[model samples]
Target: MTKFRFYFPDNKDFVDPNFDGRSNNRTKYHRQYDDDHYPHQILAELPYDGMLVSLAGVGTMQKRGKYYDQELTEDFYFSGARKFLRLDSSEYERIRLMGDCGAFDYHNEYEPPFTVDELIEFYDRGGFDYGISLDHIVFPYFKDEEAKDVAAEKCDLHELIAESERRIDITLKNAKEFYVKSQNYQFEAYGVAHGYDKNSFIRSVKELQEIGYRRITIGGMIKSKTDELLELLECLNRIRESDTQFHLLGICRFENIPAYINAGVTSADSTSPLMQGLKAGKYYSVNPNSIRFSESLMIRVRQYDHDNVQKHIDKYRDELRQYISELQDNNGFDIDLSSAALSVNECVKRLEIDCLKKLQQYDETGLDLDVTLKALIAYERVTNENYLPSKSTESKQTQLKRNEDKYHQFLLAREWRQCTCGICKGGLMNIIFRSNQSNRRRGIHNLAIVTKHKNNVLKSINPAAK
Candidate 1:
């Protein structure tokens, strides 16, 4: 099952109830401060599969003491964040840290120096799991590469891989040693970021794999590279064939999971606690069913003349809550007595909302080619996962053909070609790209045609040449 993790800021200060959900430095208040029990109270209330807290000290360290600079603002927090951070202190939650390893590089750069033993002591004091966010690793600093790279050398593939290895080795060593004692610590390494090259990205993953790091994410801040993303999918598929756990990271959108899931990705991490958090009606959060209704709503709303976006946002939020309420009833939760209904219906609804938001954002912001491909994968996955309601209007044959055509279109777009023969020398010659059964086609052997000269070469010539 895919897991959703809400990032809880670890700040201990009491937040004003009317603080307005905005961060002073660069952080945007996603969840209001609930100063009493940390974010655990919120985490325990929700029916999420996993919990992901950004490594401690990130907010204070990354943009600490910096004034509201628009460029730096956009670099860390997305647009509209400055306003969002001004939330009441009462609405904010204090995040608890279980382990001592700074989970992010940005914080590490500014974090006060602490020995490994101190980190162990923190965990021994009762920590759950510790992980490093790869946001700072794969993404260029401050979301700007050229500026950050002026001082640092462009990440050479070989050199970066070597450096990453030492880091992973240390992490793995710590995790192993820590787990042995505590028996409750989980280890994770984050790598999904947008815009990294195929070679460097894969090399980093390979290094992580060598050091026993699992749970790879695909995109971060909607900036994953298309070629590298597909290659990552391929790598994940191969890993799945060999029986390994794979995870897609920062997957707030619904349409991004199917490729990874079909390729055997075991889980996904997202933060979409409420529909209104990531822009009210837009289902950019992890809700599947919510997005379906939201998409329909957006289409209907677009038909009318609406001036302000807030009206649309409010409308979507209302509709989403209604569906969620209906799902609670369906789940047999006590609608009359129970204050909140958390069930699979709400989960699906939330995912739908996320999908709708993602699609709309892509359309509005000029979709990335890699994201476009990921969206297609999500489409395929949703259909495959039985999330999209089945239609009785279409005959089975029609449905089969449509599905076949979808795969063909994807393959064509990706320029995927199989070998013509065992030797793999010739291009796909007379290839049978599709078959009548379940979209499986015989490649290589099925497509090969023996010419006279090729036959002679196969019989007598060197096997390598053949």
Candidate 2:
């Protein structure tokens, strides 16, 4: 069996649960927040075959204030990703590190931002197992941000085709040089295939094959529809050598994993279940035993109204304090302090922690779902970034009624309760909270699920492996 692999793209998504509802606050930061806290640390613990780190992503860490605050850009260049991730540790012996140009980050540049030699230096220094050549993306097919998915098909076909070929030409030129220049490097060299459509995709893959790349990754599919992706993969399979391996870049779907593996993909990377965490008011519920989200099982928050959430917290201050007091068991929980004595920010942080505490207790003993939901809903209210504005036309009562219906479905399913992933450590309910902690945990858990599905498919195809 050609063992299929799945690599997660590192988004530097580690979260500090104690984060004071502020973005990038230094006092709240921890290098190993996921490691130390429950619902497990994603990077060290995620059961993935490999991880893909983009040079473009690292380039941004050049600024002193970001998460990788301990290292400067030159520091990273010297130490490389392997040292950064500490993949050298005995615990991560099986996990491979892959490198990419992270073209999308520098898409606006007329040419790829980094040199071939620079990428080689990076991947080699990091002890990467695989690295891709820098390739400029075909821009026209990429949907413009404001237009959503409508922009891709709406682009002039002639322009799309012309621009795709132009970019493919540049990609091939880089690939030939990258492969030749990488002769002394230990990592396997893979080139990117950029196609605006089916034939062009095949042509690019064929060109990559001719360049002596045994492994090729198909890029520019983030905007493609499911059927379109399958179609492209099917065509590539027809022309390629039987042993040639392919990867799907930036694919963010669980459903796509097994289907694409069947269509000849060996590995892929994406920002799913993790990104699901950052999205407001949305939650993923596994489809019974399956990895993909079950719409019927998913939960919806009533609102991500940051302004209203703050207003409600202020309006119900006395009631919230009373509720906390009653739950304190006479010892007086730290949250029992008068609101007047605490800063508003401190109060919100306490309530958030209290909710996580309560949720953990509920997860252990199956506490009343209604009460747990109230606490979670409270935290969700305060922590929400208001990603989605309330529809001006909808009445508050209507949103509440719909959310109630969604909550009813969520309780009936409660599949998240069955998950044994580390993210549930904060409490099974913690995985469902709309806060940064829950969302990122859900995403990491989602990636693990995808890898599990990939292995399952691989085993099904080769039954003896079981």
Give the clash count for model 1.
Answer: 47
Candidate 2 lDDT tens digits, 1-466: 6477777777675555543322223333465523333222333345578888887777633333223444545566677766566565677778888989889887777787677877787787767889999899874433223433455467665565676688889998999999898878899998999876666778888888888998999898887777767877877889988778899888846666666766778888877555655564345444435545454323433223356666765766565555444444443333454645775556666766666666556556765766666665555444443311232234654665566577666664665666655554444444554455545666666655556666765666678896
Off by over 4 Å in 2: 16-45, 60-72, 139-157, 280-364, 370-399, 412-416, 432-434
Look at candidate 2 and tell me the lDDT of residue 33.
28
* CA displacement after TM-score superposition, residue 243 of candidate 2 (Å): 2.2
Error of 2 at 270 (Å): 0.7
What is the overall TM-score of model 2 with all chains considered together?
0.75
- Per-residue CA lDDT of candidate 1, range 240-316, in tens? 32544555554433333335545656554443322222122211111122211122011111111123323433434
> What TM-score would candidate 1 get against the native?
0.35
- Winner by lDDT: 2
